[model samples]
Target: MNIADVDTPAVLIDLDRVEANLKRTQDYADAHGVRLRPHIKTHKLPRFAKRQIELGAIGITVQKLGEAEVMADAGIADIFLPYNILGASKLARLQALNERVTIRVTADSAETVAGLSEAFAGAEKPLEVLVECDTGMGRCGVQSPQAAVELAKVIAGSPGLSFAGLMTYPAAGKYAEAARWLAEGKRLLEEAGLPAKIISNGGTPDLWHAHEAEVATEHRPGTYIYMDRYQVEKGVATLDDCALTVIATVVSRPTETRAVIDAGSKALTSDTLGLTGFGHVLGYPGAVITSLSEEHGTIDLSASDKKPKIGEKLRIVPNHCCVVSNLFDVVNLTQGEAVVETVPVAARGRVD
Candidate 1:
């Protein structure tokens, strides 16, 4: 079908751009001898996950158990869950997921380790657990290298768990510091007679710097699959590199410099990412998505002399693409203005 025939406030994925992004990232990783186990949170589609593997990704990463289950059922054999699984119900689900795929998990606290042990104590095969380190991001990881070693020991001694390695989500522009921290953790682990099998760190913000951390064996990049406004602003990707764009129709031309689009928080999402506006309106460089109501997006066209007429269609690159992916049940795949296909976002509401 022609792109013009599609409805407004629609999610569009450029098939050519998606294919290029996948191959570019995988090629970069392969050249550096770094494994690409892409995080599935961005696309959340089994087809893209399989494509990543076909392009040489060792495995895939999922933030939630629901996502892992979806990918596992889709025949993705190797998966990584970088978050700590606590509650008994979640642990049971994780165990069930592990039964079908070769899955690894991460833990930052002894409490999480204990829970993992209790759940997998009598299992046939032990679960591989990685020690999550703070490494300057100051998120969900151990504070120091010593703490990482101690946690590794706890994981190794657990009945149904094995120490996999170290993992961290480093601060955006601080790759060197994070690398030193991981290096220390690696040294400590080796000295303690528990050498790490995998030292991993990831963030799309500092993707090109992955090689700086020589201690890392693999890298996880999620947003690279669908470049967004945030990625473009960070200079990590160019506007042409983005594969996802929301096609919204102009619904109002209120005054001289003001216009409204059909896309709003419900469709375009309300993620600013510290940017001055909500999203970038393609073909309207002067337009700024000033504000968004539940069903309306206010655009300030004051920067440009021209004004969009009511009912005019516009393509928008959202501030954050990952969140936008979940806002829609399905996304349209297009090849140069032709709507080739539409696929369900398999892991959209998989928040568990």
Candidate 2:
């Protein structure tokens, strides 16, 4: 089917570009002597995740247990869930998933370790847990290297938990600081007779600098598969590297400088990522996605005299591709202007 024949507000994935991205990232990891555990949160497709493993990815990373379950069912043996899994119901499901595949998770506190130990205690295989350190992201991680070592010790002592090593999501361009934090934590663990086995650090923005963190043995990058406007703006990727775009049709031409498309926040997402607009129109060099409501995207044509007329079609590169992938139920895999296949987003809305 031709891309033009597809319905409006549809997500288009350039298959060729996707393959290129996969190869480039894998090659970089291989050359650096670091393991590549591509995060599946961006694409959330079993086909892509499987392809990543086939292309030398040591494993795949999922933020939630629901996503991990989907990947495991698809024959992905090695899955790493970096988020802390809490609650009895969630832990029960996590235990069930662990039985099906090799799983590793992260912990930042003694309470989290206690819960994990209780959930997996007496199991045939102990669960692997990593100490999550907050180098600078200031998110859900231990604030200091000492805290990290303490957590690691707790995991090592827990009956059902094994201290796998350290993990961190450092702020952009802070690779050195993150490495120092992980190194210190590792040193302390070794001094206490507990040697860290795996040190994982990840962020798409600092992916190229992964080797700078000498303590890290693996890197997890989610958005590198299908970069968006934010990555482009941050110099992490070029426009030619982006593999996904939203195809929208002009539905209204309200004024000379104003036009509307069928895609809205529901389709394109509302995350601007501090950008001035929502997305970048592909062919329209100066067009700006001024605003996005529930079902309509307003475009500003003030920068250029040429404006989109009613019924015209346009492709938009969203500011954030990960959220946009979750917003859609299916994505069209395209080669040039032809749609080769439609893939279901199997892990969408699996927040639990």
Q: How do all models score by TM-score?
A: 0.98, 0.98
Question: Candidate 2, clashing residue pairs?
Answer: none
Give the lowest summed-lDDT range of ten residues in model 2: 203-212
lDDT of 1: 0.92
Cα deviation of 349 in candidate 2 (Å)? 1.1
C-alpha lDDT values of all predictions: 0.92, 0.91
lDDT of 2 by residue, 1-352 (tens): 9999999999999999899998998898889887889999999999999999999999999998889989988899999999888899999988998898999999988888999999999888899999888999889899988888878888988998999998999886677988998899989889988888989897788888887788898999989999999999998899999999999999999889999999999999999888999999988879999999989999999996678879988999999999999999999999998999999999987897
Best by lDDT: 1
Name the 10 consecutive residues with the lowest summed lDDT in model 1.
203-212
Candidate 2's TM-score: 0.98
